[model samples]
Target chain A: MRKIFVCLLVFAVVLSSVALAASSIEVWQIHSPIPEIMNAFDWAAQEFEAETGIKVNMVRIPTEDLHTKLVVSISAGQYPDLLIWNIRPGLEFQGLGVVEEVSSVIDEVGRDNFPTATLTMFQAPLGKQWEIPLFARLAGYHYWKDWLLDAGLDPNPTVLDDGSMVVNAYNTWDDVLETSKKLTKDLSGDGTIDQYGAGFQYNRKGFGDSAAYAFSVITTFGGHLFDSQTGEVVINSPQTVAAYQFMKDIYKSGVMPPGVVAWDGYDNNKYFMDRTVGFIVNSNSVISNVRENDPELADKIGVTIAPAHPETGLRTYSGSPDTMTIFKTDNTDSAKEFAKFLLKANTQVEMFKIMGVGYYGPLLLNVMADPFFSEIGEQERMFVENNKYFVGPEYPGVPSPELITVALAVYNGFVYDDALTRISVDDWSPEDAVKEIEKRVLEMLEER
Target chain B: MENHGGPRLTMMQKETRLGALLLMPAIIVMLIVIAYPFIYSIIISFLRWHAVYPDHPWVGFTNYIKVITDSRFPITLRNTAIYALVGTAGKMIIGMILALILNKQFWGRGVVRGLFILPWIIPMVSAATTWRWMFAEDGVVNFLLQRLNIISQPIIFLGDKQWALAAVLVVGIWKGYPLFMTMILAGLQNIPGELYEAAEVDGANGLQKFFYITIPSLRYVLITAIILSVIWTFNAFNVVWLMTKGGPSNSTHILNTLAYEYGFVGMRYDYAAALAVMTLAILAVFLYFFAKLQKVEE
Candidate 1:
């Protein structure tokens, strides 16, 4: 009896030892402050643990505050085992060598399944995969179809041969301005406007949103940000000056809402939801909110490609692929395995569809081809299509660490946005605004 | 060997040793929390290092030169001066007025005091958001102005470069005066009724009694409060950041917000540290004057 009891005790000790030997990884995700997203991550963690027998200490940080916190952590040598953030900071971390190379995982998972552009923007300087994109988002314009109809613009057109409906895209910036001017109206004939035309975020704040708007306009005007190889800021071009002039015209034309200079990221959302704005350029979160709260109004909404530069007839959109990177000091094996698990086509589709509204669109080719993406809804399909073709800063420029560093600096300083605001609100000449932006960009380039 | 020279007192010396031993933990904590970070930032101010980059080379006075020579540095300094002086003076004057009113026996004094503190107690983000909404063109302020027919068109208070700074400063004063009010109120309570009574007996009028008695008694508290408030207002970030974000062509940027822009946003940590060091140097100058005033009061 004593020998039997001793054998059982020995077996239990071995079992506990094996459990202790298993690897445990800590994941720091910046999707918290949203219960639905948090629940999705928590569920993913549980599933991962169940499948791999590896424990994940999932930590949640707010997205807005994550960059500073992550940098501080990295500086103190206390970065998380795995980090998921936007692609620009991932490049910064890659430059700093705080992130581990994950080329093997990409190759193992078959890199061909991911879009070339998505991978190109996130790849390291020396052609190493340091992070894997989990999702992507595009900046585009959404407008009320009824507002367009009220303004006598054909937002929805019928095919001549068949009665199939098609979205009439805004062909030029002038068209948008004209349409917006028409949309701004006094409903009560009291000489006070109850509704405004466009609702672009004009505030000189937020890291990416405001700057992204200005940069997209620059691209639309056929202005090159920097030479792909020379790393020189090329904003002094006629195209660039024209872009500033265009924005100035928009603001001066009184198409945008009054007091737009005070708008933040969420203000445009509020303006749209309040039914005070005819159009807004933002992510699909606006559409999702409208769908959830005002389904009737949501049906009247139409999605279109962003307006093109009148002269150049070009349009460029800004988007950053959302990626997860394994830090250098982490249990890289376990972290990579977990990252791969999250990147699985099925897992991504399920995770993206969380909370009865899909905000994040998948980046992988296989995931893009999935019927789930096609069957989710029309909004989902449009958002995915928009993101798939969106051109980030990496386009028309070399995806060098220097380019990213400068882009981040430019966005952070709000240099161009400030200059544009000076032109639009403060009555500075477009030439002067372009020159000042050029000077600031040059200084920033030299400093970085 | 008459140890009368220094008392040769091992007993007193032993007590001194024990006292220092008792203070060691507190001193260590202070060094860790305050001194270490301060010194580290000062050291970083001399290095040309990005925050996350491991290779930080010593740049000596180059960073300082870079920061000082930058054109925006002078503008930020001027803005900081304006913000600090205006904000401090506004808080002091308004707080004193409110404190005097609240000091008098009045109906619902407790509730009014509580209500005054509400602005200070509310979270800064919430307060800033509320103020921003109120200041919008189509918002409450515009609606009120239109109803009163003050102006034909709604004024974009936050969007106009001319009015943006004033708008932010107004919010700062609104959020800040409560601190001064409460402190001055406490100081006013501490003043003895005898002083006023004696002034009254001496045929002093209301204004004269206030000038002679209340002002003299509250001098110390006012000086301390002004010094603290100046430091705080100089470093205040949220009110401006939330309201205008140094917008409409950098019309509203103060030193702290610029440092944040350069540091966290631009990823130029070394430059940011240099800017911080410059701010500290400027504050030290103010602190010197304040210390002199404090000494005079003492």
Candidate 2:
């Protein structure tokens, strides 16, 4: 039994080595189990190998389990050459030593080449040039313009030589709500509204982005989660308090469906694709998901920026930048070369070609400006144009995120009637949540 | 002295040496497998480590304070306690009843006994996965209820906080009952039929016979089963994690899940360690109760 086991192990190793061969440098690209993910890796590998002498071997892990595997392996002195995760880039892996410092490469790549706002996301804390920008998203929804045009709203708002009132994109949150309310109606006479105006993710997983969305609304009312200089939670401040109260008022107004607080992030996408929900904040890449299953919606679907907050006009969009960190391994030279290669404009643009479109746009001024790409990236281009002065939000410390998640869950909690959802949320007033968040941040600041 | 055809041997010394040698490997395996993690955990419970780096900085009583004071701490402790109490009491009662039913001589009794143990033989991961599927919005559980005309709407079992923990309990009972059933069944089988016959001759009713004879015989096995279940149930991370991820919101979070979140996901290793220590302290209290029960049973 022992001999057979050893023999099998040896045989497996030989097979792997023979398949790999000697001249090719193996690039382990970490991604999700989704087929699109494999295509992304395979395309990158095939392209890179065609252009250069390297073989990229892609390892797929379920997105949820990837973080644990990365940490465990990295801590044990084994790390992949590059990693692209399902999570937003900064929150999961960037701040930790696990991500390589990408500053030098960014300098080489040139600051002018990259988007200034995109650069802000990598500023100290989440900053440092560890990740070569792959793609990024603006947190919002997709609407079927074809459906809207059929509803008497023009399909394309932007006019050609001939004048026409078309389905133009929303520039602000109010615009989204108004559009949804207009679009929403009962198709059936059952009295239960089959089509609803909008929904927000307030449940367990979706609650992660609640802080960004809420405070952005507050920013619309001119509120912020923290005082940039004083390091305080300002949820009690008049602007934020008004923002919080207005959200409660919105729920009461019934612009959204029942049980908004219990909805997960993916639920909104599901609702929108089914044409049951008129609007939602979701992953921009879900346009493909809609297109894949509902081809009809693909034609009608128009991608655009979320509605700006009515007052402050802060287009607060949450994004997860797909990042690649080259670790110090036995092959550090190759790692550096690959990191630099990944930052190349051609390579970055190649990612869009291979990975598909709509989830994220390139974080480069040069790439965004290409006339050839002008027709491909429509909404992301608008997101960039809309948030020209955008700065990536940073967590104050470790518990800052937890406190924020708890607080957002609290904000979401007001909408949920169930005790289960409520308990996950800290049912504190914005004041209480702010107070607890301040305390938690202080603890994190003191922690090593 | 040696054994036959070898060296002439005195049986006593040879038997003693052979027993010691054979047991040594088991002792080493136990120490490596069990003691190492426990000791490592105890050390970590006092120290802080970066999730990215393994070298931990010791922060003696701080982690303990954090665990005890955090708002979620009390709730998790309460949930774990409720789970243990409801779980233990449910298993003991159900298991004892099954043992009684199986004790009766009948045709197909062997097959019946084997069938009762199926849930126990199931892989925890596979079992949890199936339970999750059954609990899904359009899954089997709601279908069954709808089929029976018990409810009109499909209840979100893991998605609702009130029903979420109850769902976990339902799965836990199903997973745990067979253990007690098997243990007590063995204990029940050990008693001579003559004792039961004598009890019948004494004109004792069935309830009286159960109280005096069956209960007394099963006490040791019962205590052993209960203590083991408590330990297993307390640290059972996969089932709850895979099911609800301790949500509707953090409604289903216990210390074990919280520790993983902080240490691994949240990157607050010191805080997680502190929580581990508290869980150990709580479990120690259970161990004491088990010891007392064992003494009583003896």
Candidate 3:
């Protein structure tokens, strides 16, 4: 009896030791395809592992392929312990129960330190936080100073020391359109214009940029994508139709380059970098790229809030909030600990400082007090101010999985951009294009 | 120990058993790699499944019905048909012409052939990207056209809905025709010199010799090449995805890209599987007909 008891004790001890040794967590992160961002995550994982005595496995997926890969991984029953992606898909994943409720983690990290908007956005359906904000992307307009001046126009509409802008020069869509036409010039008596006025990428390719651009336009024109509560299609509203018409007129006006219809998300950035276009509405990456490659050109760059609709006097922009979601895992305790560590204000601020304004801005308001925003230049300030109003298509903001589904549908299907292109390139009437989109969006919502 | 060099079996039977044993590993590998996934996809096609959902309910043919009833289905089907038919026909015609030209006795025929093979040799993604840049509004094609006064305005080759597929087709032909050219050239080389010489002695023209000897000799090769090219072009994902991404209005979406959108972007795995199953069926039917035709001709 004594020998048997000793044997059983040894066996139990061995099993416990093995279980403790196997304690580990795997994370899949999709961020900007930059070494600094990747290295930052690597550093964080190393530090976490060293401090907590847990193994950390980190995998980097390209941003464009993140949605597909995430879906596939979950479908194949290989769920990562954590997934970092944009905020757009959080609700979808949460609805499917792939995401763990991070409320306790949020409390542990001090909920007051994070932004209220982000907190409110994540807490839904079951009053559980599905995703935690990592960083935020604010989309606005960046323009070329030299080109604007050469076109006999003032580039700086409003400049603020607090990283804000209130543009007076191109206040409305009409002003923007007219300015673009003027900036487009025929040099050397050649029939082909040397530079285009505006670069609008209408190609429906990448992660929702085209749809975001369309949403910015439509919302400014007083159009909403869906009745957020009912999930009814509101894409064919008068304001939406008018926005399409405006886009069509711009496409036909010859201010945009001929290949604007084929341009993907990066094309506009490339055009701006090449000095081939006078104006483009994008994140501050354009300015950041110039600052890196050509500091002189960077000085000649201007930043502003995106232009408002000509009639409604409303301005809007689209945001892709960088978020971290913990997947339901066997190592739930380890996963929660990691989330808390990552969201600690100092840790996040360190990451943001390393990434710089080109990659990310502080999602939490308190992180702004961490000297990251205090030492910013003019371009960074512009982005800081723009984040105040940037929201997704389900704006005037009711966050729901159904709303995100509608937005993703329009985005994935390229519905709005397609309508704009049909009107612009194929000579379809705006009404007809809007009608087609309405039908498609409604069908998608119904099917879901 | 069981049967020490026993001659219980006939020699033919022993050889057959040895052959079967030799093929066992390959058969098992095929079953594991190909057959399992193929059967799994077919099974999943009959269910309503979201990747993240816990339950994948068996919906009978409901998934198939949903796929067929999708408004984008008919358009995608039409686009696939156009892409395959046009790409296959164009590649074959261009391949034949190049083969005929290169089959002649020429001083630098080998060098010319090497130059023509560059498109095929270069990677598809790289070639597609280069073509995309070339077809851009301010690209070299437009630049040259503008310099020569061909058009007053630049053309958006990949942007316009009506022309996007055509632009993709041009790139497809550029990348694919070289394979057909090489195959047909080999076929042309195999044609009997005696038949050609006899036809020439009968005062047959170049066209007549091509019609009488070259084409008939190359018929099998042409059919096989066409069938292969059709299969490849129909399932092509990278070129179209890179160049247009089935965009400007979803006008260029083919089966593969559409499947990707549904499965990945939309997260509707069942619908994507159903669509894929249908695409495979369509290709299988075509292969059956084409293979039968080849057999009949033989």
Best by TM-score: 1
lDDT (10s digit) by residue, model 1, range A331-353: 77888889999988877767766
lDDT (C-alpha, whole model) for all candidates: 0.77, 0.62, 0.79
* Model 2, span B1-298: residue lDDT tens: 5556866569998999899999999999999998987787778778876664346777788778877877778778888887787887788888888988998899999999998899989998789778876875556998899889898777777766778889988888888899889888889999788888999999989899889998888877887888888898788787677666667656788779878777766566677767877788889987998798767856
lDDT of 1 by residue, B1-298 (tens): 5655654658889899899999999999999999998999899899987764568899999888987897777877888888999998998899999999999999999999999889899999899889888988888988899899998898888888778888888889899999999999999999999998988889999999889889899998898898999999888898887777777567788988888877776677888899888898989998998798778867
Tens-digit per-residue lDDT, A1-448, candidate 3? 9999999999999998777645788888775545677777777888888898887788877667777777777767687887777745566666676778888877777788787777767666645778888777755677777777777777776754554476555667898899888888887575668788887876565346667777788888888877766656677889988888888888789888777778877788888788788778877666766777788989988777778777666777876677878877677678778877887778877777666765577777677678657888777777776777676656655446656656665666667767766786678988898898888777666656
Which numbered prediction scores highest in DockQ against the true structure? Answer: 3
**Each candidate's DockQ:** 0.55, 0.22, 0.57
Off by over 4 Å in 1: A1-23, A32-35, A157-166, A311-313, A355-358, B1-11, B294-298
TM-score of each: 0.91, 0.77, 0.90
Ranking by DockQ: 3, 1, 2
With a 3 Å backbone cut-off (N, CA, C), the pairs that clash in candidate 1 are none
User: How well does candidate 3 match the true structure in TM-score terms?
Assistant: 0.90
DockQ-best of 1 and 2: 1
How much of the true A–B contact set does each candidate keep? 0.73, 0.25, 0.79
